[model samples]
Target: MAKAFASQGDLTEKEISFTEIGEGLYAFTAEGDPNSGVIIGDDSVMIVEAQATPRLARKVIDCVRSVTDKPISHVVLTHYHAVRVLGASAFGASQVVMSEKARSMVVERGQEDWDSEFDRFPRLFQGHEEIPGLTWPTTTFEGRMSIYLGNRRVDLMQPGRAHTAGDIVVYVPDQNVMFTGDIVEYHSACYCGDGHFHDWPRTLEAIRRFDLDAIAPGRGDALVGRDMVNAALDLTGDFIRSTYRPAARVALRGGSLKDAWDAVRAECDPKFSDYAIYEHCLPFNVARAYDEARDIDTPRIWTAQRDKDMWEALQG
Candidate 1:
């Protein structure tokens, strides 16, 4: 636990890197932090997932500015996580887009989630005071929506529920690149506190249907080449399965929460110990896995108090 806090205070924010994944498509990845994608169309730019705060998003905006001067007309939220969507205001996009389910989740539990996440990962929320409020999508869709940036077409599709009920992937067809939020983490720990463990594998399958040459995951390095893309997706799927199945099995056998937590830790930590945030996410992942395994469909809402209590129970 002390080792986990060792890097917790290392909050030296770095410059955002704009990597050209494909033609006019770039992935803006910070140093092992949450990532945002950029799609440059003929006329304007579309940003996927805002950073934790306006100040952080400005760094992403600065990266975009270096590549193109196009106005960011749209900000697409992959899900409603505070680290991913709270920076929407900084983009100043005319329309902030999200799935209908995500928008509803925000309306229902956004404040609690914001508080919970801020406490859990203080480094990500460097400028929490500047957050305007809960990020509400100005426009939302049910299944899928297509928007053309001049001739470049960006497809927003809810392949299935993985990270959250409203996880959406931004697909650029011409480039065969997909910007998958937390659904596929490349060498980064998958945060599964609000995830759908059973449906996550199916969601990964849906993501594989696309002929993706490159994948910009929610965190870590941008995956290039089909092999790396497939590997990332497979590794993420494996992590989810390894975390949930063993915990669920223990819970079904009437094991205590601590028992299930130990089971999942034994199974997952060895393989994923070297991944970023592995220690931080394991406790929450085990808790959620135990709940879902016991037929708790809707994940229990995590408030700030609940976060502290759970952390003490599991990690203390």
Candidate 2:
């Protein structure tokens, strides 16, 4: 028997948890599901990573209402993935913030990404109809910017590129808590379909410079305390390096794509087999790694049709 197409086989709903890592920082995570971070300042709130649709976003809003009454003033997008950005409308945030690179990526491939992601994981797109099309950023910065919500400071920085060409991290310097969106996944498998393999570790090194007491990664439970934070960062780095090393070696040797795919699975599965979305992400991750190893700087745009084709070739 063959495996089901990407995430199509995943039907189980994950249990959600809202953990307070700091006085005003919360991590909204669903057992390995895509996570969201909530940052509450003295007067306003900022959401890091919107859910897939407005209907799905309401659940986060409910979570937000449970804690703070401060109006959501901003929605910060770490990167331009449909699952993370399409739910912006539900927050009614006055400003949607992102990096200039992220905005450009959205303008270039947001629609195709929307269709590609929806088809790959329909369960996450439960409120597909409620999406008001592509989520656009109201404010964009070139490198890094500090946002003050009534005196409390939050720094948003583009620490090079990892998961995507325009990945960003939300750092609260005083709280020592960072919301690392997709740049560092916890137990969840790192989705590298749109990633840059070589630059990823350099970006991770950039993130490590922060004096973080806690971290809320793109997926999985939030890590609190320095030891746990370091462990999570190490795990994310290990996953990325393990997946890319073997695949890249095969690609550099002029091996077939199948060889690269096999190399990644052989190298990565032994360690990451229990990680969430490992199976679903392997083929796409290997494909991207292969391209990167072959000197392809830019990631290919993923469309619904391209998704099916790649799955059929590598995972079918």
TM-scores, all candidates, are 0.96, 0.99
- Candidate 1: residue 133 lDDT (0-100): 92
lDDT tens per residue, model 2, 189-269: 999999998999998888787858999999988999988888888999999999899998999889999999888888888
Clashing pairs in 2: none
Best candidate, lDDT-wise? 2
Model 2: worst 10 consecutive residues (lDDT sum): 203-212
Looking at model 1, residue 203 earns an lDDT score of 94
Over 155-207, each residue of candidate 1 has an lDDT whose tens digit, in order, gives 99999999999899999998899999999998889999999999999999998
TM-score of 1: 0.96
The models' CA-based lDDT, in order, is 0.89, 0.92
Worst ten in a row by lDDT for model 1 = 1-10
Query: Model 2: runs farther than 4 Å from truth?
Result: none
Backbone clashes under 3 angstroms, per model: 0, 0
